[model samples]
Target: MTLELQGIGVSRGIAIGRAHILFHNQPDVREYLIPAFSIEQEVERLLDAIEQAKQQLKSIRNHIPANAPADVTSFIDTHILMLNDSSLTKVPVDMIRQRRCNAEWALQLQRDALINVFNEMDDPYLRTRRDDVDHVVNRIHRILADQEVADHEIADGRLKGHIIIAEDLTPADTVLMQHQGIAAFVTEHGGATSHTTILARSLGIPAIVGVESVRRYVQDNEPLIIDGEAGIMIAGADESTLKEYQQRRIAFDEHISSLSRYKSQPTRTRDGKTITLLANAELPEDITTISNAGAQGIGLYRTEFLYMNRLAPPEEEEQLAAYRDVVEGMNNQPVTIRTFDLGADKTVDGGRHLTQTVVTNPALGLRAIRLCLTQPAMFRTQLRAILRASAYGKIKIMFPMISTMHELLQARNLLEQCKLELDKEGMEYDRQVEIGAMIEIPASAVCAEMFARHVDFLSIGTNDLIQYTLAIDRIDDTVNYLYDPLHPAVLRLIHMTLEAGRKFNVPVSMCGEMAGDPRYTRLLLAMGLEHFSMHPNALLEIKQIINETDLSLLPANTLSIMEVSDALEADMLLEQINAPIIIKICLSFGFLIRTDKRILII
Candidate 1:
């Protein structure tokens, strides 16, 4: 009999292949007392395990295909950094010495302590980081128990052209499986915002996650079909069901092909309002996607990747070459490169040497502009490189996590110094390069007018803004339900920032996940935002939404909707305004019609 399953689809595509189940059961690490003298030996064993895990992560990272996206490297680097973190390294060693416990027991104790802190976190994104810690500890435990870690032998020509079914896959596990030509993956755990899912999306693989008991219901070599768009999985699928899905997949392909025609079309609403759609890039390979997606420019170029997965800070030449490639690749499109957003749990490339202290809560600790200001030499090198690259094309510099006027002034003063140094060296570069700040923290959002007066532009990074405003992590499943983008407070902050940008005559753009989603397109456009930057994959859908919208028709309803105090009511109001045939309004221009089944046509 054919059995169907439902899960949260994180990526879009389809595949039909034999199931290859990988067990991810937690290892049993029994607590047993060791002699005081053997404590030294146990500690050595633990350190060895940590070192071994780091080597494996590096090997996996190195194995990633050259054509793979930049974020894949970042995901692997994050795990490797965790292995090097004191909580995982020194804490377990101390536990072994102080508790006189075996290596496995001591590691588990430290893992629990770290996870407990994460569990108590108010943010959903940080709370899910507990899984990263869990995956690292499991790797070490496997080494301590002398067991073969899963995917250790994946390169031996085993897992090819199959659908991977697992309890859960770490980012490293996903990268390895991808290298082996795996068709798709189904996991029993993980939410849409998890790093694992993000990697899958970046790899363009079909994946479904959070399917409870999916591993138990399926077996190795079982024939299966995965519909990533519909979040449906079929085990031993019948011929009729397969045929139906096959046609749907063809239709999806056709729809994508149709979207390409609009690639060269201008992004204008029905009333002739033009919106600048930009791409958020982190890697050089991303420029191709951005150009293909017809983005007006690169709005947010995260520069942290240059400083990650290395032993030292990027030199001026190295940084210059990287930035120059992106600027040149985008042709004449403007590229706004954000400075290193490291610190917190995102430490990488021996950056701990720069900070020299472990941050208890990385979110509020030394990171972004704070870290840059604290390390002026390294910061100066980056500024010179960015300034040098600006001479090649339209390039802008952006600072992240600025919460006060003082910090922005301090950063601007440093920029002036870098410009002076460049002039002394007789280098020619763009002296009028635009500067921008990310409005993420509530204080910055509330004081957006102050920032607008000083900067050329302001970009809203709603990922952090919502997390900080609601005290909810977007990744934690426990409280993820409360992660509301439509919350009144979040909207108010956005409105204030937009109003300030208008009053000060500065461009305001949103470059977060919310910017990519089409659901909020009308609301944001009605709010007077003229620019949006998002992942390349979502650019087409948003463009479709923009073509059919009339900004004039939305002001009254959008204002009324924003005034609603309750989220549910506000949500209802938005739906009412977004309905396809509201008030039987006749249309002079093309309109998008979405049925109850959500099949869309424009």
Candidate 2:
């Protein structure tokens, strides 16, 4: 009998191969009283393990294929940096000595403390970072316990065509397995935003995550098929099932290949409505993919990376250089740089600038514009750097998480102040740089028209908009099911923002995950989203959907979806909106005929 399981598909593709169960289970750790003489010895053990873990990571980083995405190497670098941090290295050693405990137990204690801090973080992205701590600590525990590290090389090439089933995979493991030519992988744990998932998408590997207890249903070397788009894994399939999937796999590959034809083509709907497709970039290295994907320009260049994993926020010159690289790299393609969206809890200067008071919910507390306003000095530094970089290329400034008119005005005032400072210093910059605001908060969306009157453009950040509107943490598996982009309220907010843009004659764009998702491309287009910015990998596919869409037919259907209160009804309407033109026409005829019959009967 065939067995099937469902999971969240982070990447899009299909794979059929034999199962390769790769376990990276945490070693059971036990605390033991250490003799006074052995206290120093116990600390040395932890230091040695840390050194080994760092070496292993360095080796893996060195062996990473030159063709791999820059993010792959960056992930490894992060792990190595974590190992070097005093919290992981010196703090654990101190605990081992102070408590007179085994090295593994001390590390475990420190890991729990670190994870508690991350768990209390309200931002989903920051909360998920605790996984990195687990990954790094697990490696050290395994080493101190004399167990083999999980990221060991598969020298015999036996996993070349197999599907890996694991409890969870670290970024290093994903990168290594992909290098060995693994067909795909599925994990029993992970969310869509995990580093492993991000790496899977970047590596172009078909993967499914959050499949609970996947190992219980499958045996080693069992033939398996995984549909990454549908988030399904099938084992012990009948011949007919295998044959069907084989054909589907072929078609999927062909369709992906066909998307390349649209790389240079204009993004226009069937009715000749032109759309602007842009790429969201994190690092400067993303420029190559963004350009090759034929993005009109960088829609969202996130500046948070400059503040992350550092002791202090980047200096003006340092930030200018980094921003200049991307600005010049785009070769005059417009780049929209969003200011640092960091929270007070996520201080870049090692808690030197963080509030002493406990923030129960960092997401709702001081963050983004609020945090920037409180720290005017830091905000001005970034604004000055952005202004300086504008002289090098087409640059636009964007402020994140603006919830009220007051916040918007205050941010704009800071920008003006930065401009004046630069002028006094005789700095050459783009005085006409376009300024924009992000509509991610419900309040901001509701008051979008007021904001549109101020900014040059508006970008709907649906990721946070949906989360905040629904009052659920999307990264939380328990309530994440309630996180729906098609909810009546979410659509209404989006429509309000779009309508506001139209009323003020200002351009509106979407830079959230919704923009990259092809499933919502037509609905968004019908709702008047002419500008979309997403990951570079998703540009071509979204462009394909846009080219095939007929805007003339979508407005009525989209409006129907917007009017429906029930989510199910809205979903039904969305499907109709995305249906093929022929199918849609037939449905329209059928609806009209049914209405005529009802009228005659009445």
Candidate 3:
């Protein structure tokens, strides 16, 4: 009997192999009163465990293959830095001494506290960071419990052709398994944005996460098939099914290999329309990947990472250096640096200490432009740093979450103030540095024309726009189903923003997951989005889709989709828009076609 299970696919590909179950049960930790005399000894035990965890991560970092993505090393570096943070090290020791509790219990308590902070973060990407904290804390907990904290290694290439089934995976474990030549991995727990999942994508491995009780039915050594694109796992497959999947695997591999040709090719549509494809960057390490992907420029460079995991905000000089590195790395390519988008409840000392309030709904509470306005001093420091870096490269400043003209003006006013201060100090900077506004909120999307009048460009951030327009938490598993980018309301808002940009003669770009996704690439082009920015890994694939698209054939079909109220009907129309040239010609010629369960005649 063939059995199937569904999960969240984070990385795309196909894998067929026997199962390799890796059971990593977390050790139980209980609190008990400790004698005052042993308090120091208990604290010392925790310090030692913390030190061991750091060394282990360092060792893993050292062992990462040289051919691996640069971000791979950065992920391990994040874990090591978390281990060294005072919240994990000094805070736990203080808890042990103050509460006279066991080291394990103290560490567990601190872990819970840290996770709670992460859970309250408004950004889905930031919220998933709690998984990193959990991975780090669990390492120390295992060490304190005298258990093996390292992943068990098989010396004879036993795992080379095996599919790893696990409760979850840390970035380190994922790296080690990839090095050992695992075929793919499926986890019972993890989100799409977790560091482990991101690493899997970067390493070009087939991976699915958030499958429930996957190990319960998958026995060790059972033959299995994983479709990472569909988030499907199959067991007990017959010979015919195995043959079909083998053919699919070959075709998929060939398709991936063919994407490299688009790296140096121009992103022009079949009808001769040139599209500007850019890459969204986070850290300076991404510049190399962006360049290799042949991105025209950096469309969105998030600045929040500089303020994370630190007691104080980065001073002007440090930020200037980091921005300068990215600007220089791009070698004159335009870099749009978005101001920090931290929320009040975010786990950063600068944000929490300044806000000093427990926000019930951080999503709707103080964040992004609101937080920046509240902390003018911090905001000015960032503006000055950005201005200083503009002298080095083609830099643009973008403001995030600008819901109202008042907020936009307020932010722009501060930028003007920073410019005047730099001028007074005789600083060399770009006097005409372009400014843009991110249309992520419904209010901003509705009033985009007004924003366009004041800024050089408008970039739609569909991740937050869809979430806000649909009134759903994108990261909440229960409500996330309602988060739809294809929703009629969302499409209308996007269309309105694009129209507004056109009316003002301002360039419009999209910098969200939707921009990178191949499924909606044609639809977006028809809707008048000229610029697209996404992860560097997705650049080549998106460029390929753009090169094959014919803009002349899309507008009418896309307009029909926009007017449809039913999501299924819109999806069908979108499929027709993206169909192959033969199918499209048939549709245009009034041919009847049966696809799946639907029969349609044009």
Tell me the tens digit of each residue's lDDT in model 1 across 1-602. 98989887788877888999988656788999999878888888889989999999999999999867777887888899878777777877888888898989988887887677556443344456678888889988888888776652469757787999988989999999888889899998997767888899889789999788898899889999988756789997788767766765565566556667678889999999999999998888678778878999999998876775456788999999999999999998899999887664453543233555655776777778888888888889999999999999999999999999999999999999989988999997999999999999899999999999999999999999998999876665567668788888899999999999999999999998889876688888888888999998889878877887887776476766656788778777776656543222213223333222343333
Show the lowest summed lDDT stretch of 10 residues, model 1: 581-590
> Where does candidate 2 stray beyond 4 Å?
351-353, 581-602
Q: What are the per-model numbers of colliding residue pairs?
A: 6, 0, 0
What does candidate 2's lDDT look like per residue over 128-170, in tens digits? 7889999999989888878865543654577898999999999
Q: State TM-scores per candidate.
A: 0.76, 0.94, 0.95
Candidate 3 wrong stretches, greater than 4 Å = 149-156, 350-352, 581-602
Please list all clashing residue pairs in model 2, or write none if there are none.
none
Global Cα RMSD, each model: 5.8, 5.1, 3.4
TM-score of 3: 0.95
Question: Between prediction 1 and prediction 2, which has the larger TM-score?
Answer: 2
| TM-score of structure candidate 1 | 0.76
As for TM-score, the candidate ahead, 1 or 3, is 3
